[model samples]
Target: MIKTLIIDEETVNVLSYASIKPLWFTDYQIPLSLEQRIKRVQISDKLFLISEKTTSESKLLVIKVNSNGIFSELDNKDKSIAFDRVITIALSQFGESISPGKGWGRYVSGKKLSIYATKRTQKNKNRLYFDTSPIDTNHIFAYALDSNNNGFENIEVDESLFLDSVTLIDEAINSSWQNTVEADDKTQYGIELTEDLYRSFGECLNFEQWYENKLTNEQRSFVDKSYDEPVRLKGAAGTGKTLALAVKILKDAYRFETEKKQKRLLFVTHSFVTAQLVEDMLNSMDSEMNWKFLEHVKIKIVSLYDLAQELLNYNLKKFTPISKDGKEGRKLQFEILEEVLTKKLLEAKFKVGVLGKCGDNFKSAMESKESRKPLLLEILNEFACVLDAENIVMGSDNGDKYLTSSRENWQMHLPTEHERRAVLELHMGFRKYLKDLNVLSMDQMIADLNRYLMSHEWNHICEDEGYDGVFVDELHCFTRPERMVFHELFRLNKSFETKKLPLFMAYDIKQSVDDNFICTVKKGSGSALINSTNVGKTNLVELTQVFRYTPEIAKFLSDLDGSFPALDLASEWSELTLKTNTPSGAIPKLSLYSDPVDLIDNVFKLASRQARSLSGKKTVAILCSNFDLFEEYLIAGRIKKYYEPISSRDDVTKLGRLKGKCIFSMPEYVAGLQFDMVYLINLDKVEVDEDNPSCGAYRRFVSRVYLGASRAKEELHISACESRQGYSPILQPALSSNSLLMS
Candidate 1:
């Protein structure tokens, strides 16, 4: 006897009504009469069909019967079968009439079942369930279905209800059939199977994937280009030089790969932080390809100093550098010179007759410690000038000319021959003293590498084997001497084969903040060690598209640099605008406070607000001029627990503190790093002049502020104490502009 089950609206909504047509009912092998009556079917170990339905006064009555259910059960005792087997039988019922497309999958939620046949253009889906409760007095079979916006008019159904035509492509239930749960044994007449079957599918993308997805077409073209010779890529801040460099490196590595041979690529940067970032990018790119394929294409990313140290010690010789620990070693050198001068003065009875006409002031300055500091610094500066220009790394002709120019530019007067002789002796003696201790300062090490590379051994080695490609990021921080060393070490390949080695350099000259190591190209007409014209073999590619900043921020940065080349907005910059929640038309914020405390407070408030907008892994920074001020602000802000102070020293190893925290950084150390927001403090301390474009102080100030401003990808909040000396006159135009948003 067949019984009828009364269904309510809530039950119908939960069971999601959907159509299921019998396109291949003959594959089920049920009798023609039974197949005709089978209006809706529920799939499990046994199949139950709702042959007929009737609408009562207040409910809908559905009759479901299981007479010789077509699907066979693997386990009869428990009435269980494989979930995949049920899908296979159900799919076969449709057979060749319905193109299965990319096969079929099912999703189960409690008693409800959702199955979909996926195709590239369209999806055919169905939902099913079977239940029999004695209180209900009959078995009920439910079905749910939907289409993926590809239009449902093409879908044919025999005896099933249609759901609203909402897109179900993203619905998680489409793949839920990968898991199976057993029904209760005492569910009256339904089948129950105890088994666990779940499988995870689909591709999982990492962070780099999301980032690279927005690469602009021009940037992609540059990255994908195969260079036959060295290429120098110049760009302003936010121009994605580092990303392009990484892509170029990967392209070169794989493009030059041979069946039995491989090429070596060396990527050098200015700081450990930047080097680590490059290395991480390379590793991520490498993982996308077969690891075995990359075995031959070995890539080493390191700082310039690291390369210097390795090359210096490559011959099993230990030439350790003496640690000055914040001292430039000039003070000790000055003391030695003073002692020698004092001895000479005593030998000459402190007489003006025996020494020179200008000896009296020099003697007085040397006698007192307070008066001697500046004079000593001057002498040291001149001495370094001589050493740098005369170093073995530079070309002999230019080195000699530079040495002559240095002597001509000397400020101090040593008129008498004896006094001049004594000064020369002091300089020579200082050199001897350093050599006696077997200690080489960075200067001495650079000179040593220069001499070593110029030797016959290095010349022969380069002829046989040389780096296939040399990629340098943050190239703006490399001084003339360093650039010369890099050029000779890599570019002095006497043999230009079928493929000329590529030396790729990426830098923004405006970001060179450190006075001691400013970019070589802007030094002078003749000072560029890596210029395209000066060096006829080199190629210059300017990446004129900015990606990291909005047009407002980019224009502001351009104003700060004054001399920085203009750039176009990147196509991908629209995505950056979408990600950054800053209001449209917002310029970099510049605020002047009467009180230092209020300035710090306001900066922190802004930082806190910006931090909320970024993910936990994103970083924020409070950049100051020096360490002492950084510490004071870090303590006063009462946020030392959440922030770490990064050092400005050359050997800083505190990179592990960069992620998921705020940082107190100096302009020099923060190069090649970006934060979601930057609080540039102590701007009043920077010295600047509007009248004198040639002023070194003004240029340095502009460079430093440019670095600080560019470090911010999303927001830049600059504050200055009203009473301070303040920054350069170059910023006057920006400050006076109405769009600058001064508070």
Candidate 2:
């Protein structure tokens, strides 16, 4: 057997270690500058002498590297086969000396092999040892390759002697390699390897081979380019915006570490779950680099809410943050809003016959129990985005300013001045309720935090402790108040007091799920955080390469984007170009069921089939468009066996627990997450009318569907129950273009 293969640095970089069937070892630590010439002196088909040419004098350096070091480089099948072959050879050569007891053969089966060498003490001989546990230092004697010297030298030996020498060299290498392995183990090398394999599986799901993580020219330019002002990264879903941000963060972290320059960098996301996902992504991007060292550089990953809480804590502002216990928090907020609205209505003494200035529709909605929820939601949006964001206190001077100000974004929810006044009253009641409870809403927290940061005291504090650079992900999802906080969070430079630091924002206007989110980049628009001046002065890299999904999915998303009225309106200001680099995939399927029961049944059946097709190793997400369906599916007896409910509040640890299981969640919860296959159920519940496609509800529906469908890396399955009115008009574009298959 050709047990050893020698290669130079160039060859090692591009070698496909998995393709080499016979168990062989190669040195990966060869220096590229050596320029060593290698000559293979073939002794036999299974044995060869590789002579290396050195500058000083050519000498034989027979080094046998530990195979365990490269164990992770091989595929799972190759790893198992290699382990079996090693164990088989050990048993045949040394018999019981290698076997510890009667079940030893079965015990070591399928386990990774690790080798160790013990020093010659008074009671022990200089012999090699083997075990399945990589951490174990002492183990049973498998076999010994006799050697007089501790290191290799220029010498000639017979075939058997050469084999023994090679084995002795391998043992020597393993002994020294143990310390390095121990260090790597401390850095979570095993977890990183598993994550790498997970990423590899995602890459090969649709394609036959794994593609390199090489960045496109545009992406590379954006990542490597230095900027003094703010830079905005714009792209549609799967266009590698987040990837570019992560890479830039890593590159800067490494560069700063190398230069021994302490830098304070902040990676801000919309939610904690997304922050955790970004942290995991950064770790996986460069597994070998010890990320702990970056702590000295002060690189922090935090959500906007978390950053607000931190600021509040630093300033000793005592208030409870809103509950993040999944849907419970949102439900509580809704209930509180309802209570406030009811109290306001009662205080106004508005009855069925006698309506207030708010209009008949508003009074009717408030009177009807079933209609209250939607009205409450609209009121909440208006309160949060307009009143709270603008720091408008009801019955105050700011309130008058808000009443007189041009309500551009509020036109959809609160068009008339009377409706706006009613909403302000409700907002005032809501604020009073929260004040009594000492709890802060997300909008309130950001507004309060921004106010604090604007003060002179905070200006001094930030000057000393502020970040050198800021990286914002999901920029389109951030509200105007949250976006304003970034300006004060970075170190204040006297030269650019009115401007920002080296801020990098990754956004896709089409992915903005919130109706309140500002999605314009025009200068002085007051909607976008990064204006055209900043973008033009720095850089606005629009990445068109969609590497996350297949060309088919990209085509479908593009078609959907083109047909969406709101997205079409957005295109006048921002561009969305999706060009995929992946192989052609199966067209996304839209399955219409007779009813909810049939829809649920077919979703599971299809998800199960997809799971089995991927050998039950790939992840699948069953996304519900509404909370009702999500709750209903939780108790669906069939789902208990295959699906796990993933909440928005779930941390990375909770996510790890549901690793190979299908995840059941809403589109909002799985914002930054990806799956091998996605089954977006209850599309009918999204509810968009063709006549009102430009309405807030319609835009939200479009965003929800786009967000859910983009989560599928390989395949997408969208199912909805067929009502008397037939399918949702949202699917018309995909259906018309044949981008979606009717199943």
Candidate 3:
């Protein structure tokens, strides 16, 4: 696609060629000795240039003229002096990282063009004609390669960056930290902090700096060292919440294992696969914040579910929960899993218990939620006698308080037992994990009791210690039942004055709104009550700057058909520059022509490709909003050549496995966690389901449209029938109109 014109013995004559665009890049150079500097010269009244070895390659001088003239016409004397010139190049050296029209654009120059100044400014209205207009360069040169020209030496054609920009970034971080660390201060960048934690803001810079992208003070600030209590984080698709969580996990683990050796921190998520991913991320570079010196730390990573399941599975396989299995006085074990579901455990027990439960066909009691409770209770009654009530009931106190704003209906309900029960289990499980991890005893749970009442027993529970803190992520995703459980524990802590209480809880509540999560309770349920002094005021931190999207992409996200709520929040820094006039196309395409039959063909092909990751490698899931849609995609004609779509796996390992690559296909119920990278496909359909109003059967069917989209890292490849434009509210920072095609 590119051609070069050589000037062996040039007598330049080309002038005024293209009418629409008056000029093009033309270069003139002279070969000079390594020791030679540049002999400066002035051409006309506007141009001055010289040859120097400063920018990597030593070359001839450059001249930009406003009038009609070529290099060979440069008077007999100047032309003759260039006889030693070896080569000349007209190049677009990956020059433009900045899009001038996209909000306050600034040109970041390199050392080669270090002395030049780009367009000082463009009046706001001038951009109106920007699409069909020529660039307003202010007749000044803008960018360069490097201070010494060797800057982008190894940069790929597609991945070039300005090295000097990193220095500017380092400066910004050093300048802002003293003023930016707080939950209530307003910054020059307009970012608001939600917590009062400060780390060297500059210290958080990532590889993006060379690409002219870096996290803002707010985004940087949000990546806290630790959370005092369970927290929620919300952000658009591009936001760095996940990255922050990854970092938080690392720091917490490092502190617990190194500084507070006795304590442990738990990174809990919904699925075993996600837990595995959390493990992978914890091991990623992002988590190694202070790497060069992070020695003497020991830690283990596992999902809350996996850990519990492993313990239970250990008991199931090696021993029995009933007395028949025990020796030293039948240590009948039971787990009140700090988990949302016991899928793996149930699956394992189901097969074991189904071996003729009675006469004809009795499924394992453990396999059925319905049958397990009765059987377990029978076992528990005989082994572990009931001495206490399970789970906490946390809410509020004083008079006239209600979960809802209006106490008109005392009998009105906010959450049924189904929701409350899940909340309770998770909360109790969290505390239990903390207790075990810290090696704390029942007495230790209340050792620092200043006012909170977290103690169930007042005796030494552990002869050792536990994790420094507990990290309860995605709190927004939890049901109200879970929160009720949290209330009891914290209320107890408050009453007993447990100095061991969490320093704080980190949450991004913004996502909660989309999850359809609301704080609610029965009338006079203590939900409306608060600290007497802090009663009217609820303390919160807000992040105003969004560092994820480029300025251009950020604007498109804000303006895209009004589907995305871009403007509602502002960005401290822009990562993209809008290069297109209007976003009309740009969908990663998986074209299905002809009738609906074409789509059906691709569907099956999609499923076949997914059946490969079920092995010990990792869990992989294929997702679609509906089962029929899943079938349609699995049966697609073209893609069907590669896949064999089906719901049940005869043996998860039959499909074979991949190294470093894992993917699985399943219904929404199966799509609960994350993977190293995720590719969402055939997602064109969007129709409302009448049943399951609690958003239980909404677009996500399993994941809320809001939740499913959040489950990926670094890459999000969606194959949809809709154009990128049609994918309005669903995807933020709309893909550029100049999109890349995907089959």
Candidate 4:
């Protein structure tokens, strides 16, 4: 009788030369690759005769025979057999070189074999062959066979070796294989194989199954808690803030169904891409709660911009917000501002003294054609963050309000009433241009919707159609007026008149990359929302442990956080920390290439190799810092097969359907999503002058790098071409702390 320890479809081919047959085999249902399956039996005990039959020839085999049965069947007269010859013959079947040495020790595949002697025999006289290869712990102590010919025929079955070998092989197989066994099955050997897979690879790739049983105590508490007032959940990147919010939505749908209550819930994200991601998250949580129940609950997941468009369409017959034209609305707004400045304001008697009063070389910046864009952007930021955000209309009572109001956050650029009046004039010109076109900007659309929501007609409509609860993801991206709209959208539930509306918001101030949106949530301000007087009191919940990326990534991000003093001041609303609950992984690789083409080629080759080795079981992202590099990689035919460019909302919406291809995107486009591995290319393109590290450009550049680096859940590869000025000054902190490996 023979026992099969492990066998695959290729087992028979490997065993054909030895003329061995396996009687029975057990299907463990582990999804191991063919190579792994072959390696498993190649390093197994000789007695474990493992073989499988398929439609084609088998490729792997591991044989384990019953020692007593084999010995008894041998002729009694020829009691002594050459055990070394048998071991050599069995190993030769694998088609690898084997060197002979004293005792049982030999070299196979450049790995030395260790000799283990049975207690009954002398240590060096009678030995068993065990390969102690550094290939991995799985292959350690794999082979076992007697060496001494003196007592080879009298070799008794070593029960201890037999049990230990089986246990080691079982552990190895479980680690390499996917846990495909049914949860209800009682005969399964291992239940934590999926978790092991997540730790080895990354949980982001297997998100549907990753968090079902892996939620930390803090995450679970957030999901299961009932809110009296509006709740604000704040955490650094990878802290599971979005995951907790999704689970709460699922649980709420379940509770509504159980109570036989009809409820309307709203989930708001920053953009169409993030909205699609939220929908995918909800669909993936079907195991936690039946998704069909959500039909009765009437949950709406939409981006704030889209929601504003829908509301405007409902109120006015033919209203359309200006299309951003693939530049995230920034390019279009810049064109309008340029038209207002160069064509309208500059042509008119524009107060040149106002530019001089703005300080920090504002006049020189406006005079130079090359430096004019940043100047225009600063003026535009004032309009968006102060004017539109506060609903201050030019030539109205709010004009006086803007001049007298505390511009503490805006004092750097707008030092006095002169600059404020100039910005208001530009705002008036921008509005006139938009009014002539009959199309509103995204901010204008949101402002109109906010006014509509505050109307008596909207109050009457809300009584019957308003949402019972509202959830906001990435709340830091929303401006003051946008935040106010969330409070107005939810109706006062009759059962909880004393409590605030059930508005839940999750945000991390460090991840806010938009220059137009300024964070106003102060430390110990007793409010998490900016200008919270409009939204009322809210409760803050901080998630301290990061469950997405490894400790190495966490430390790298923490070092980055400490390097930026401006980031600390901006994030004073919460004490940001990056403590991780994940295992330690490879330090992020920061490689500098002399040639730009070589950097791109090397990064893609590394990604391709990783994709092949993982068998497309993991997701990879290559985030380019600028559009030029992004487009360059998109057209490069050599690496096109390995990745798909996520440049538009349609591409982002199809992310869940993408298979066997890495995601190629800019850092800003892939916000609120994560990957198994991330490669940030062209950090040298991110212009940040060390002399003015406190500049807004430096802050925006740091935010972009942080966003891209935080996307990696397990591994991060950051590469750049060495410019004439050397590496980007932004990497100094990571380099000084030795948090990044120079590959």
Candidate 5:
């Protein structure tokens, strides 16, 4: 009773491995067997093949079983088992490879064959079942036989049964910050604004409408709507956690304190730039009523890192900062809880290098600032030689060697060594801050980062000297190794801080790039925080009613996203790409040269055409990573080039949003929002040829490539530097894809 099942398009002519072999039996060993019977297999509880998949449309399943009634008597008390388990399978001969069915349908489904599904026996009854997955469609077909048995020579099976794969990934094109979601629709659970407060917030909302005609995307509405006790916001990347927290701060700012005679609530956050931005936006609003909190101004701001930094810097009267490491040290030592953190950063010149050709895809995972593999690869060939060097790598056990010798070299243990410890400590601090604020887990991490930032540590330092609470912004960067120091801060039962503990913090937790959790005073209580919200999922909220973009662009970008891989999209959700509605205009352009010169030339031509006008006030943006490349395009003047360098922090503030005329060659972090014109470079990574002389650095530039391409408004024309086409398609789904938008 061997079972076998196959599924494909209902309308298509499904062909078997026709004319290969008839039904017969033989022992395992493929060289002797015919050409068609060999298929891929996996063994487990009740072996199954990862053969079938489901798209947005339909699902396909393939199964296999023995002809000796091996599956017929199975006692499947569990409802999870499917009916296909009892069918018999027929086998044929397969050559070295099997042909896969092709179409523009969803994806590449698993092709499965045999599996080692052991039998389960019940009292006085023979039973059989496929013990592998009955859910999550990557796998199809189940079996209890070792695929190599070759017992059957004459069997018939379809060659193209299952096909297609769908995964979640980022397919977004980055845009300026001002590109906002409209406020036409309120959030799923928006908090009510009181009479006076409502008047003020409504006034600000009106101002936002007048200024940008849009609202921020709907943040997960837990803390945003309800203010009770102990709520926390947390999530990775563009999940809108920070936006939620920001909204919470504004809504809550004047709500309390004024109702009772309590002190005004303060905002704690990460940096002055962020604070300045928030304050600026808040000031731009017009209030409808005579709101005491807004009029009296109870809300203040601060940074936790600045407080600690000041402690070390002044030492009551301290001074310093010459080098980057030296500058990084003051913050690292405090976050690491080390009185003096001493470890010289490996010198840029003497650094050891290994794994010369692995490329940048590997670098994204590195936790360290420096990488030696690139440096190592440079020295191998005289032309590729970065410098003369002796390279050696050791195996994990230290009992082995790779190419050269030096058991457990620095290159081997470098990336995660320092930063992991440091960041973990800060992570714990964030948890403690949330607990103290009574905002334990309701909100996501990104929201937690924002709430932490709007703490009163920065703007309201004077108020906090004698104040009862502590709040800080940019907690991740300021509070290195968050899990460690914050754990102690979270201690309850015993009074660790009779006066106060400096636990307030805010950060872009999504961008922290790690999954560090807050240590709990109570274990189960901590567990609750882990899955408080659907952290990794997109479409967690209803954004359709909130969407502000043109309907077509919104739909196009989101639709294009389904084509990209899941991993890439998971890394970046903030940026979404949509070509602009602005008609073609000649604005001066800059050749941001992350790509090669030819790409610069071509895009330069395209941009110059749009940037230049007869008036000659042509201001175009030629964005580049480094300053030297910016000049190269400026000097070439290929397409009416306008070169505006962002050398200072102040210049960064006005780069994209600057009025009158200007060209912007901005960095990745500062590219979004405020920019009227933006042209990104290298949307996708092009494969490099081994024969090419420049294949050397191609591996090192992956991250810069991802960060660089995301900065654009409207038109996204990727200029492929190399001849290679096709990049891992990045996902940027249309907002309308979610029925919530339509609703």
Candidate 6:
């Protein structure tokens, strides 16, 4: 029995739907492109095509399969059934165009029938394949308003009236029938009854079937939860913050479409690679939705730098990005600063300022004896934090007062007034240099954007329809300058009355890759980095449910947790209580090797052997603090032949294909990914000194190690050469607590 169908004109006879089942129909003459017709097949099988040259006296061409056992008037010798029929009975019973829900007299003894149409032929309609296949008995009836303004409700009719009612209609009187056939796929023509027909007609539809896997209850709650005010979701690594953000954007897009409102979403992250991963995961969830209008929903997933470029229109005539990778950018600025500093300090005899506090001379300070290049590079690296902080701080005010006030808050030492002046001079010189060259560094770009937003041009963004919500993943990694960009964007609020916006951020301060990148808006801090006083207040929500880690791994991570003396740990650090089982896997292991080379070799061997044995499909990841050493091992062991290096910017969509192979990754990139087994190497690289100011640095190091340790689903292997750098003091507790199988 055929129940429903679609048809079109121009009518190439594609017999893609020849089976005896509950059939549905559409017009063959309907306006649909070739690509759309192929996609339409995924939901609907049958098509009902009407002829172009039909008249009141014209005959009909009916094409069906011989196995359906319907047209006895047509011989089944050649496998396909084709016949002509009169229109009088069908036209009178079902209306002008022949369709389901009405009678086809004397066909299959009044058994149900359905007719559908296609604009184009999917396959050769003349050739029919026979089958002894069982027939579908279920009937589905669904309706959506047809934009054609036709009298009949566009409903999926039952397959009972069996006259292959190839109907002929009066063309002059039924001219509207031709218009219905040529209407575009836009909803104004009619609501697309495809999904509803596929579901209600045959089986009860589950719109959420695409989300059946991946998210846990807590993650889903965060994705679906609604908030009138801004929110910050904090969680440790592997707690699905990134995935939840993507899901939330998808749900928001869906809701916007359902409500007939424009959808605009802005998702900001730290790395281009991470942004790509979010895009891939979102595309995976619903491949059927029209991605053509992705921008209509304002679905933008971009790195912070990319967002800056976009807002600036990427016109080099406007502002060129500093070519820091070459001789032009910060490198040139460093050289200029070195020359000026060296001359000034030489004049002061490597001065002690007026206070006679001594500092290093420019030449000795700029060059590292070991590398023979500039040690200025190392100092400048440290200076970057102050530079960024000052740039953002100066955004609100001039550099003099902000620079004076922020000197004490910097990461590096500038004890003397001369050294502080030198730092400010270097900053002024760099700003002048960039101004002359029409260029800006990343931080400078953000500062410029902040300034631009303060002008009248920003009124367009404020008044126009922008993002309904803003989601920032890896929020902890944002520096003050980068966060200033967020602040400026949020300031352009759509809700002018309350001056409030819908913003959501996800971060784990414990998973802060660099302590320098930490948000300055701590618990008792009078000021907010993003300028929202609601920071760490009721707007903050912590996700404590750990979905990725096993109980064994969770137990180990909890033991390694350290108190952040500066932070309100209770708010920023979400505790992990494992939500999964251990499932009798290997206890976490500590493998000590004789040397670094031996350690790398053994780790690769172990990962390869595990790849073959652990279900033959388990993934292995090697996490380390050193990327230089990771690359060396990859070349020495030919590890690239066996596995992929995922620490760099590449299409993350290809990661799934490389599963069961050992992937090398930096600890920072492991934020939202997992593996069956994880090897945390170079443990000795992190020195956990309890007595120094670097105790905070040690906590940051421990946090990175804990992130890697918790990535393992079944096994975790930690390797170090005690002879080289000695076992880390931080790992001593896990080593002695009987939680690790130390060898």
Q: How many residue pairs clash in each candidate?
A: 5, 0, 81, 15, 138, 39
TM-score, prediction 4? 0.64
- Model 5 gets an lDDT of 0.30
Q: Model 5, range 1-743, lDDT digits (tens) per residue? A: 21343332110011221111111111111121211222112222111112122123322234443353233333333211222122211111111001111110101112323322222233322222231222434333333332233322222232222121111101010111111222234411111111110011223463334324443333434323432222333332223333344444544555554565344444444333344344434543423322323653355443322323232332112122111111122222233222111121232211113212223433332223333334222111111010011111122332122223332211222243232222222233433443443322211222233333334443344333332222333433322222222312221302332323323233332232111221111232322221222111111222222122233333333454343222221322333333333344332222224346666666655555565541223234545543345546556654444444443222343332222334545343342222324455543333323244223233223223333333333333333333334232232122235311211
Alpha carbon deviation, residue 222, candidate 2 (Å): 1.0
How does each model score on TM-score? 0.56, 0.67, 0.38, 0.64, 0.40, 0.61
Task: Give the C-alpha miss distance for residue 648 in model 3, angstroms.
Answer: 10
Candidate 5 regions with alpha-carbon error over 4 angstroms: 1-244, 261-271, 286-297, 302-595, 602-641, 647-650, 660-662, 671-674, 687-713, 723-743
lDDT of each residue in 1-743, candidate 6, tens digit only: 33323222212212211111121122222334222332221112333444443334432222332223323222233212121111212321221111111111111112222221111133422211111111222111111111122322233232232122322123222433323333443423222222110011111222254245555766766666674666677676666677677777887787777777765677887765466456556645655434324544667777676666557654323454553111123434455556655554545533444213425554344333333123344344444545653463222465455445544342455555455555555555556666775656655665666666666777676545345677888776666556655645653453434545567888766666454344344444423533532323336555665656676677677656632334543334444544453355676888888777788777877786676566436678888865456657767754556556654332132344453557777666555566778999877733455565244456666767876787787788888886657567676666667667687
Question: Which scores higher on lDDT, 1 or 5?
Answer: 1
| Candidate 6 vs. true structure, TM-score | 0.61
lDDT of all predictions, in order shown?
A: 0.47, 0.57, 0.30, 0.59, 0.30, 0.49
What is candidate 4's CA lDDT for residue 341? 72
When 3 and 5 are scored with TM-score, the better candidate is 5
Model 2 reaches what TM-score against the true structure? 0.67
Ranking by TM-score: 2, 4, 6, 1, 5, 3
Among all windows of 10 consecutive residues in model 2, the one with the lowest summed lDDT is 95-104
Best candidate according to TM-score: 2
Q: Model 2, range 636-686, lDDT digits (tens) per residue?
A: 897567666764443222343344556778887677677878998888843
- Per-residue lDDT tens digits for candidate 3, residues 567-666, read 1123311222222222232233334233334444454344344534433233233444444556555555565444333232111211222222233344
Report the C-alpha displacement of residue 676, candidate 6, in angstroms.
2.3
Which 10-residue window of candidate 4 scores lowest in summed lDDT? Answer: 190-199
